[model samples]
Target: MNRIAAPELDIRASADEAAPPLERPMRITILQGAFLPVPALMGGAVEKVWHEMGRQFAAAGHTVTHVSRSHPSLPAEEVVDGVRYLRVPGSDTPRSLAWLKVLDLFYTLRARKALPAADILVTNTFWAPLLLAGARHLGALVVSVQRMPKGQMRWYRKAACWHTVSSAVRDAILAEVPGTEEKIRVIPNPLPESQGSGDDGRLGAKEKVLLYAGRLHPEKGIELFLDALRVEAVRSVLVREGWRIEIVGPWSAAEGGGGESWMDRLRKHAEGLSVTFTGPVHDPALLRDYYQRAAIFVYPSLARTGETFGVAPLEAMAQGAVPVVSDLECFRDFIRDGVNGRIVRVEGESGVADLAEVLQKLMVDADERTRLAQAALAVRTSHAPERVAAMFLKDFALLSTLAVKVSH
Candidate 1:
């Protein structure tokens, strides 16, 4: 893989008085698997991260183009903020992971042409390296992002760099490709700053509402959340007062969810309970308001799909909700047991019991909830977009140098 210097952008307020010449604004492109709508439409963690990254890159005076699958409502070509989105025709969702892979593979071949010629290509698609030959022609340094644990590793052999959201994800990749340790870097997802408009939703309030936001998939532990909410200890408090459980997310056949079967089952299972299912709140202002209104946010994800950094809980924390999440390996990045957020075990009969007890305790204890909410707000500062963006920009500046060294 011969290297070429990425063309510079005119980002200078004046030339590099602080930054090196090579550190000048560079064209960056971010790619995701087919039809994962950008956040403006309805997307998951990967899309959210890609949209935020592109905005950050563009804000820092770089040209950014996001290449993603098109939606019926969104225009084929549109520029939002400073980032230009180039949405190509692709499917809405697939029946299973195997099928999703086939769709991703086909989309990769087509992406080569849709992808912009740029200095760096940061992607979450499993088959990005399949386009390495095409990427090389654009002089783009391909950085493979480990979005999940089970992606195909052979394709990564062609990537110039690998970005991991957590050490667990990095380990998962290294276990498959041991020789690439030198190329890997752990970068936590950058959280956008609070819009500063909603209520803090801190604990110790008169009324408490529990909230869960994100995908309604089985693995995400929505079932467990509903079950725990039914527990005698949890149920008694909610029914006694007028407290409610609000579950908000997007679930559709088009979004890879099996239409209404899973949701119908969940609702039927929670019959007689006061649980409201608000399907996929896409408006940022409205979503932020939900988080701000939440007294406690719970995410009991139990899937073994290499659960990497869970973003919903982080967002909840930023919005001043006392987050209660399952004890997953990746969550240790921010969650400190009883310190910042509550950590519950939901694996077995005993684990479920623990989760029920944790929720019960948080519901009853006001001062403790307030204490946790205070620490939880640190998520906004620690993972601020400016800080995370600076880290990636620093590395992008050195990619040319790294490319030269690796080409040997």
Candidate 2:
């Protein structure tokens, strides 16, 4: 990789001796690929993390800047919640294919020219760690956050460190690039606490309700969710008990959705079933309410994106809802079968049958639900954003310091 040379600076001697500041905060910049930041609450999990983490880093006294796709409604540059937002090209378009990485390549080159000097340059982009490797040579500690298991070691060779979202991703990366393990760290996504739930870890003032919140992509497994509901035993309980299965998300192509046609297809399949598609609740408060009310939460995502670390189930867990997810290695990073939540096997002879059976169990037995829900609530504090942010800052600072020492 070609290294970018740092600019030469002229130092002048001063007559008076002055003491340096006791504490200096790190200057951090996050490249959010093509995700929007401001007025981008509904979809795009990548942007959601940048917005939240940017604010937390800024609040912790670090100077933070976020570079993401720009919106016409949002300004080209502005400060929100202490983080400075810098808009780059590619807002008019969303959900483009891998070819769009060409745009990302150009964007990184453009950002390198204009972005202020930083101690840390963090990116969630798959090829960015390698694409923007020159930033590391310029004295910025380049960190790649592996949100999915998609690429090889070449993509991460120049990164100061790779923050894997789960152990599955960490192992996958190590399998291909065993030499990078020393520079890899596993950090789970941060969770914001749920509101409106009572002290006893109980749910809303209603009956049995099932909930699903995420993108309406095929990999997300909305069809599987509807299929599980087709089982006679599961269907009987939902119909007889007057329960509702609510699917909440932004299923439009612009918001990284599977497009309206696919959503329409899902609705057709859900016909005659007590299913409600409350398409993409933008308000965080309203989303939390849905989590708090739903007694059973199901996420059967079978996407080929490696179905990396998920944030939806943890949010539902915080709201005291029992989560029933497909057997994804990402969920296993935290969820324990019949403990904090239940994981259904989706590969065997009775895949759908097992899911339906688990849903029926949660619906019929309140004690098991209570036990899991309470344990779910108990984990919220440990994964709180504040604690997660502190861990992130510590890891970030340590890596940056090490880079500076090596350069010296």
Would you list the C-alpha lDDT of every candidate in the order shown? 0.74, 0.72
Q: Evaluate model 1: give its lDDT.
A: 0.74
Task: Give the count of colliding residue pairs in each prediction.
Answer: 1, 2
In candidate 1, list every pair of residues with a backbone clash: 249-280
| Candidate 2 TM-score to native | 0.88
Task: State TM-scores per candidate.
Answer: 0.88, 0.88
Over 14-115, each residue of candidate 1 has an lDDT whose tens digit, in order, gives 222222334567878887778677754765677877688788778888888888888888888899889998887777677777888788888877877787
Cα-lDDT of candidate 2: 0.72
- Locate the minimum summed-lDDT window of 10 residues in model 1: 1-10
Please name the candidate that would achieve the greatest lDDT relative to the true structure.
Answer: 1
